[model samples]
Target chain A: MAVRVQREAFDIGAEIDRLRAGRTSVGAVASFMGVMRDFNDGSGVQSMVLEHYPGMTERALESIVAEAGERWPLIDTLVVHRVGELRPSDPIVLVVTLSAHREAALAACAFIMDFLKTRAPFWKKERTPAGERWVEARASDDRAADRWQEGDGA
Target chain B: METAHGSVRVLYFARLREAFGTSGETMDLAPGLCTVADLRERLALRGGVWAEELAGSRVVRFAVNQTLCPPAHALSAGDEIAVFPPVTGG
Candidate 1:
C-alpha cells in the first residue's frame, strides 16, 4: 500500500498501474477521484487552497488505508491526495484498491474514500466572489463514514 | 518535580491559525494543566478574541502528537499538540 500526500498533481492511470505491476493475483482494480468544482454553497468559487498538517496528514491516510486492508482481502492500494491551490476541474484526490475479486476491491475503495473525507486532516478554503471562506464540515460526510460501522460491507 | 521542564509545541491550523495570528508556539505547561481540555480552557481564560475563538461555543478539534485525540487526552512535555476546525478533506 502507498499513500502520497503532495502538492503536485497525480496521474491516476500511472498510480493504478504501479499497484498492479507484476501482480497476477489481482483480479480487480477499483478507483475513485475527487475533483475541485467552480461552484459551492450557491456561490461561484474562483479557487481553493487545501491546507493540511504536515506530519499528521500522511499518518491519517496511512491509517485509513490500513483499516481498509483489514476489512478486505486487498492485494494492493494507492491513495494520492493533493494539497495547495486548485481551480475548477483540478483533481483533488484519488483512491485505488486491488483485490482478487471485485467485491473486495469495490467496497474497500468506497470505504477508504468515505473514511478519508472525515478523518483526513486537510481543510479547504475556497475563494468565492464574496471572499475566501473556510468550508465547513458537512454532517452528510460524517453520516457517510459512520454507515460503514453499522454492519458488514455492502 | 521539574514542572518547568514540561513544555510542548502547540500548533494551530486553518481558521484557527488565521484568527490566532500565529501558526504555532512553544508553551510552558501551566501548573495542573494535564489534559487537552485544560489547555484550551487556560487559553480561553486569556479573554477577548482568545476567549471568543477557543473558549466560546464553537467546536474545535484536537490532536496530540499528530494523531487525533479527545479533549481529555493527557499532555506531556515534548508533545506536539494541534488545534483546528473539523476536517473537510476527501
Candidate 2:
C-alpha cells in the first residue's frame, strides 16, 4: 500500500503498469480518478487551490487505506492526491485497488474513495466568476461514508 | 484541586487562515481551560471575526495533536491544535 500527496502530475499508465508488473497473483485492478470541474455550485470556476495539513494528511490517508485492508481481501492499494493550484480537467485524486477477485477490488476502490471524500483533511478553494470561496463539505459525502458503517449485510 | 495552566500551538487553515491573517499562533491556556471547547471559547473572546467564525452554528472542525477531536476532548500542554472549516476533498 502507498499514499502520495504531491504537486506534480502523475502518469496513470505508468502507475498501473507498476502495479501489474511482477504481480501474477493480482487478478483485477480497480481504479478511480477525480478531476477538477469547470463549475461548481452553479458558478463558473477558473481555478482551484487545494490546501492540506502536511503531516496529518498523510497519516489520515494511511489510516483510511489500512481500514480498507482490514475489511477487504486485497493485494495492494495506491492513493495519490494533488495539492496547490489546479485548473479544470486537472486530475485531483487517484485510487487504485488490487485483489485476486474483481468484487473485492471494485468494492475496496469505492470504499477508499468514499472514505477519502469525508475523512481526509484536504480543503479546496475555487476561483469562481463571483469570487474565490472555500468549498463546503457535501451532505451526500457524509451519507456515502455512513453507508459503509452499515456494512455489506444489505 | 490545583488549577491547571498550560500552552498549545494552534494552527489555522484555508478560510480560517485568511480570516485570522496568520497560519498559527502559540496560545497560553487560561486556568481551568481543560477541553477543546474551552480553548475555542477563550479564542472567541477576541470578538469580531473570531467570534463570528467560531460561533456554535458554524461548521468549524477541531483537531488535537493532528487527530480529529470532538469539542469535549481534553487538552494538554504543548499539544498541536488545529481549527479549520469542514474538509472538502476527494
Candidate 3:
C-alpha cells in the first residue's frame, strides 16, 4: 500500500504502471479521481488553496489506507492527494485499488475516497468572486463515511 | 526559536486560524488544564471569537501530537495540540 500527499500534480497512468510493475496476480484495477470545480455554494470559484497540518496530514492518510487494507483483500493500493494552489479542472486526488477480483478493487477504491473525505486533515479555501472563503464541511460527507462502519447496514 | 520549560504548543488551522487570529501559541501549563477539553475551555474563555470558534457547541476537532484525539485526552508538557473545524478535502 502507498499513500502520498504532495503539492505536485501526478499522472495517474504512470502511477498505476509503477505500482503494478511486477505484480502478476493483479486482475482488477479500480481507481477514483477527484477534480477541482469552478463553482461551489453558488459562487464561481477561480482558484483554491489547500491547507493541512504537515505531520498530521500524511499520518491520517496512511491510517485511512491501512484501514482500507484491513477491510479488503487486495494486491496493492495507492492514494495520491494533492495540496497547494489548484484551479478548476485540476485533479485533486487519485485512489487506485488492485486486486485479484473486480469486487475487492471497486469497493476498496470507493471506501478509500469516502474515508479520505471525512478522516483526512486537509482543508480547502476557494477564491470566489466576492472573496476567498473556507469550504464548509458537508453533512453529506459524514453520511458517506458513516456507511463504512462495521455494522452499518448499507 | 526559544523553548519553554513547562509549556504546550497549541496550533490553530483553517477557520480556527482566521477566527482565533493566530496560527499557534506556546501556552504554559496551567494548574487546572489537564485535558484537551480543559485546554479548549481555557482558550474559549478568551470570549468573543475565541469562545465562538472554540466552543464545544461548534463542530470542532482536536489532535494530540498529530493524532486525532478525544476531548478527555490528557495534556502534557511539550505536546502539540491542533484545533480545527471538520475536514472537507476529498
Candidate 4:
C-alpha cells in the first residue's frame, strides 16, 4: 500500500505498471481517481487547500486498505492523496489496482475508496470568490462508507 | 525524579486552529487536570467566548499519542493531544 500527501500529481498508467511490476499472478486491476471539482456545497470553488492529521492520516488509510484486503483477496493496493494548494480539475486523490480476479480487484478498489472518503482525517478548505470556507462532509459519503458495515460488497 | 512534571502539550488542526486562534500550545496541567476532558475544561477556564467555542458540542475530532481517539482516552504525562473539526478531505 502507498499513501502520500504531496503537491505532485500521479500518473495512473505508471502506477498500474508499478503495481504489476515483477508480478505475473495478477489478472485484473481496478483504480479510482478523485479530482477537485469547481463547486462544493453550492459554493463556486476557485482553489482549495488540503490539510491532514499527518500521523493519523497514514494509520487511517492503512486500516482502510487492510479492511478491504481482509474482505477480498487483493494482490496489491495503492492510495495517493494530494496536499497543499490545488485548483479545480487538479487530481486530489488516487486509489489503484488489486486482484487475483477482476471481481475481487474491482470490489476491493471501490470499497477502499469509499472507506477513505469518510474515515480519513483530512480536511479541505475551499477558497471561493466570496471567501474561504471548509467543505462540509456529505451524507452521501457517510452512506457510501456504511455499505461496508452491512457486508454489502461480499 | 519521575520526569512527569512538565506541562501538557495541545495540538490543533484545521478549523480548530481558527477557533482557538492558535495551532498548538503547551500548558502546565496543574494538580487537578488528569484526562483529556479535564484538560479541555481547563482550556475553558482560560476565559472569554473562546472557551465556549472550545468546550461546545461542535463536531471536533481528537487524537492522543498520534492515535485517533475519543475524549475518554486516559492521558499520561508527556502525551500529545490533537484537536480538529470533522474531516472533509478525500
Between prediction 1 and prediction 2, the one with superior DockQ is: 1
User: What would the per-residue lDDT of candidate 4 be over residues B1-90, giving only the tens digit for each residue?
Assistant: 233356767888887787778989887656667677777777778877557656677566678876777677767767788877777877
Give the candidate number with the greatest lDDT. Answer: 1
lDDT: worst 10-residue window of model 3 chain A: A145-154
What's model 1's interface RMSD, roughly to a tenth of an angstrom? 0.6
Runs of candidate 2 exceeding 4 Å displacement: A151-154
TM-score of chain B of each: 0.90, 0.92, 0.90, 0.79
- Please list the residue runs of candidate 4 whose C-alpha ends up more than 4 Å from where it truly belongs after superposition: A151-154, B1-6, B47-49
What is the C-alpha local distance difference test score of each model?
Answer: 0.92, 0.91, 0.90, 0.81
Model 3 off-target regions past 4 Å? A150-154, B1-5
* Tens digits of lDDT, candidate 2, B1-90: 766677899999989999989999998866768899998888788998899898558878899988899999998889999998888988
Q: Give the best candidate by DockQ.
A: 1
TM-score of candidate 4 chain A against the true chain A: 0.93
> Which of the two, 2 or 4, has more lDDT?
2
Please report the TM-score between candidate 2 and the true structure: 0.96
DockQ of 2: 0.83
Which prediction has the highest TM-score against the true structure?
2
- Work out candidate 1's RMSD over C-alphas: 2.2
lDDT per residue (tens digit) for residues B1-90 in model 1: 545457999999999999889999998986778899998998899887779888877988999998999989989999999999999987
DockQ (CA atoms), all models: 0.86, 0.83, 0.77, 0.64
